[model samples]
Structure formats: structure tokens, C-alpha cells
Target: MTEERPVRWLDEAEMAAWRSYVVATLRLRQRLHRELTDRHDVSLTDYEVLVCLEMQDAYRMRMSELAVLMGSTKSRLSHQVGRLEGAGLVRRGRDPEDKRGVITELTDEGLALLATAAPTHVEGVREHLIDLLSPQEQATIAAAFERVLEHLSEAES
Candidate 1:
């Protein structure tokens, strides 16, 4: 067998950049979550789920598919969906094609809540992020994130 090679460490600049990126991302998410929660009484996760459902063709998606899209486990998703259902913001139904599968659908109340909250969320995003970056910078940032996403997906595969 060939000798194993030692792993290279990040350079000082790279280490600093990585830490800064992590800190900034965490802070941004926290701020966004707080803003949404305080103003709309909705958790960031709930807002994400609502957005996902609203964007779907029928304002609904299979439970398993939603779990994957939300980057959550099926159990966690089920719990969240139950909470939303209790709040009368969402509903669950048996999938038409698959008798054993469940589908999550957004309620009219959920859509109304999303409509009310979306403008404020967009404003917060503009104030905290989009407005701060020049158009070219925005494009560059998007491209960089796309590359990172592609790299991560490839790694997973």
C-alpha cells in the first residue's frame, strides 16, 4: 500500500474568510428569523415551508418531498406539519396516486398570512442584503453560491 499523505490545512487568510463567512451567515439568519417572528409570529421554518408550498403547482407537496426540500427529517417535518395543522394554517391529505403517502397542503389562512408577511420579509431582505450589494456584486454572489451548491451536491452524490 502507498503511504498516506497528510491533509493540508487552510492558510491564515482562508481560515479567516471561512470563519467570517460562517459568522455572517449565522448572524444574518438570526436577524431574519427574529424579524419574521416578531412581526408575523411565524418561525423561519414555517415561513420557508409556506413559501415552498405556495410556489408548488397546486400549493401542495408530498410529505416526503417537502421533508427533502426543507432539509428536515420526515419525523421533524411531520411534527411541524402537525403544529401548522393545529394552528389551522395547513392541512394534510392522503396522496391521490399513492394510498400510503401523505400530502401537505397550505390552507387559505396560510396563504393570507404569507401574503401579509411576504412584503415585510422582502423589505427586510432588501434592507439587510440586496440593497447593500451592487447589481454586479449580487450577480457574483449568486454565481458563487451556485458553485458552492453544485460542489456540495456533487460531494453528496
Candidate 2:
């Protein structure tokens, strides 16, 4: 049996920082989502999925890998992809190298949609997040998040 450790409660400054981060991120996502949905008729998640597929050399990726990249569960990604597939933005196919593996390929329609939506997404990102920060502050945020991501990823593995 291991000994229990005392909880290290956050102090006022820490709590303030935590709350600010939480609220800012939540609102930023909502604002971005609204902008994309209104202008492009695409949800933020679908836009992200399209972007991920477009980034690949073949404009395709295994569903499982895409799920990992999206930080989503397989079932959730499957449902999301199903919606894209129904809309003709993406198609699901068997992986050539692995019969059991499912691959998602971006359709020409998907690429076109992404091309149209990219500007809106970029502008939203800039307006809501990037443009709000100074160069030094941006660098600090990048460094902090990179460290946090690395630590969390290592823990997962």
C-alpha cells in the first residue's frame, strides 16, 4: 500500500490564472465555431478533420491515426466522419496495406470546402487568440503548452 499525499490546493493567483485560461479557451472555441458555422456551414470539428486529411501527403490517413491526432475516441471520430462522408466531404476506404484498417480520404469536394473555410478559420484564430497576444507572450504560451503537451503525452505512453 502507498501513503496518501495531501492535496496541494491552488492559491488565489493560481486559481485566477486557471480560471482565466479555462474561460478564455472555452469562449474562443465558441466564437470560432460560430464564425465557421455561420459562414461556411461547417463545424469546427469537421474543419479540423478536413485540415488533418489535407495535411497528409496522399490527403488520407487511417481512421485510428486520425482519431489520435484529433484527440478523439474512435467511436466519436467514426460518427463525425460518417457525417462528413454523408456530405460528400470525405470517403471511407479499406487501407491497402491492412485489410482490417479503415482509411479516410478527402474528396475534391472536401478540399474545395476546406479551401473556402481556411480563411475564415485563420481569421477567427487570429482575431480571437493570436492577435490578442504580444510576440513575447505568444512565445511564452507556445513554450508552456509544448512542455505541458509533452509531459501529458509521456504520461499517456
Candidate 3:
């Protein structure tokens, strides 16, 4: 039988950092979701999806690309898109250059809704996260997460 290696465990400092990050991230998302749902009748994920499309040219993006950007499977994204479509917020169509590819486009109604909801979302973010951090702390957090994202992205390829 192969000998089992001893696992390195987190010490107190590391555990505190990790636990705080986990809980803060979860509660932050929940608070943001609650604000959006209460005021705008939109979930956090839906707001994120709309924001993603808005960042694209002409407020349109390929379904596959969107799925990747959102870190979601195509099937799950499809269901989410379907719900948005039913709400008249977005629509899907074939990409003209590639008939096999599907494209998602934000509708005028969607843009209006996003415009209305933007302030509430921004204020919530500022109040819940940004205002809590000093400028230096914000910069440090951004840099640290950028490194984390870059390392994880490299692993994906």
C-alpha cells in the first residue's frame, strides 16, 4: 500500500482570512440580490447577465461566449436567457456570420430596466463593499484578486 502524505493545514491566521472571505462574499451577494429583487424584481444573476450584454458591442454577445464569461454551463444559461426573454428583456437569434451559433441581444426594454436599476445596484455596492474599504485596501484587494483570477484562468487552458 502507498503511504499517505500528511496534509498541510491552515493555521489560525489563514483560517480567519479564509473564513471571513467566504462569509463576506456570500452575504454581500445575498444583500445585493435582495436589494435588486425587492426594488427591481430582478435577481443578482439576471442583473449580471444584463450587465454582461451591455458591455458587448450593440449589447449583443454569442451564447457560448456569454456562458463562459458568466462561468455557467450552456444549459443553465439557456434557462436563464429563456426567463429573461419571457420578461421582454432579451432575445436570441442566429449569428449572421455563423448560422450555427446563437446570439443574445438585450432589448430596448432591457436597457431601460437596467438604466433604472443601475443606481440602486451601484449604491448597494458602494454601501456594502466599497465604502467599507480604504483606498489602499481596495487597491490591495483588487490586485490580489487579479492575481487569483489570472492563475485560475491559466489553469483552465
Candidate 4:
């Protein structure tokens, strides 16, 4: 048998910093989610999906592609799409090239809603995050997040 190795552990400061980061991220997301949902009847997930659709060509995307963009499973995306469809915010159609595939398109109402809510969302972001940081700090934080994303992508591959 191979010899057992000791487990690596965080130093006290590292542990504290990690814990604070975790708590702050969770709390901030929760607060923002609550604010968006309460004010506009749109969940953060809905907003994210809408944003993704809006940025795509023709304000539409393949269902599978949208799922990837949202970091969600197809089934979950289907449910969310259904909700948005029922709200008159989106529409679904069969993909012309692939019979088995579906496409999602944002509606005019969805665009209008986004236009109304974006300013409030931007203000909230500025109040809670952006404005609190100096330009240098903001750049550093963005770079750090990009590094984390790259690491995650590499690990997945």
C-alpha cells in the first residue's frame, strides 16, 4: 500500500478570509435577488436569462445554448422558459435545422420590461458593489474573478 499523506489545511487568516468571502457573496446575492424580485417581479435568474437572450442575435438563442449560458440544466431551463412564456415575456419555436432542438426568443414585452428595470438594477449594483471600489480595486477584482473562471474551465476540461 502507498503511504498516507497528511491533509493540507488553511492557515487561520486564510480560513477567515475564505469564510468571509463565502458569507458576503451569499448575502449579497440573496439581498440583490430579493430586491429585484420584490421591485420588478423578476428573479435574478429571469433577469440573467433575459439579458443573455437580449445580447444574442435577433434576441433569440437555441434552447441548449441558452442552458449553457445560464449554467443550468435543460429541464430547468425549460421550466424557466415556460414561466417566461406564460408571462408574455418569451416565445419558443422549433429549430428549422434541427427537428429535436428548440429555440427561445425574447418578446417585445420582455424588452420593455428590461428597459424599465435596468436602470434600477444598475443603481443597485452601483450602490452595493461598483461605487464602493476604487478603479484599481475594481480592475483587480475583475482580474481575480477572470482567473478563477479560467481555473474552473481548465478543471472541467
The global C-alpha lDDT for each of the candidates, from Candidate 1 onward, is 0.92, 0.97, 0.98, 0.91
Rank by TM-score, highest first. 2, 3, 1, 4
lDDT of 3 by residue, 89-133 (tens): 999999999999999999999999999999999999999999999
Across 1-157, the per-residue lDDT of candidate 4 in tens digits comes to: 9999998899999999899889988887777778888889898789889999999999999999999778899999999999999999999999988989999999999999899878777887888889999999999999999999889878967
Per-candidate Cα RMSD to the true structure, in Å, reads 1.8, 0.7, 1.6, 1.9
Could you tell me which 10 consecutive residues in candidate 3 have the lowest summed lDDT? 147-156
* Candidate with better TM-score, 1 vs 3: 3
- Write one digit per residue (lDDT tens) for candidate 2, span 23-50: 9999999998899999999999999999
For model 4, name the residue pairs that clash: none
> Which candidate, 1 or 4, has the higher lDDT?
1
The lDDT, on a scale of 0 to 1, for candidate 3 is 0.98
Candidates in order, TM-scores: namely 0.92, 0.98, 0.96, 0.91
Q: Is candidate 1 or candidate 2 better by TM-score?
A: 2
Clash count, one per candidate: 0, 0, 0, 0
| Cα-lDDT of candidate 1 | 0.92
Candidate 1 scores a C-alpha RMSD against the true structure in Å of 1.8
Best by lDDT: 3
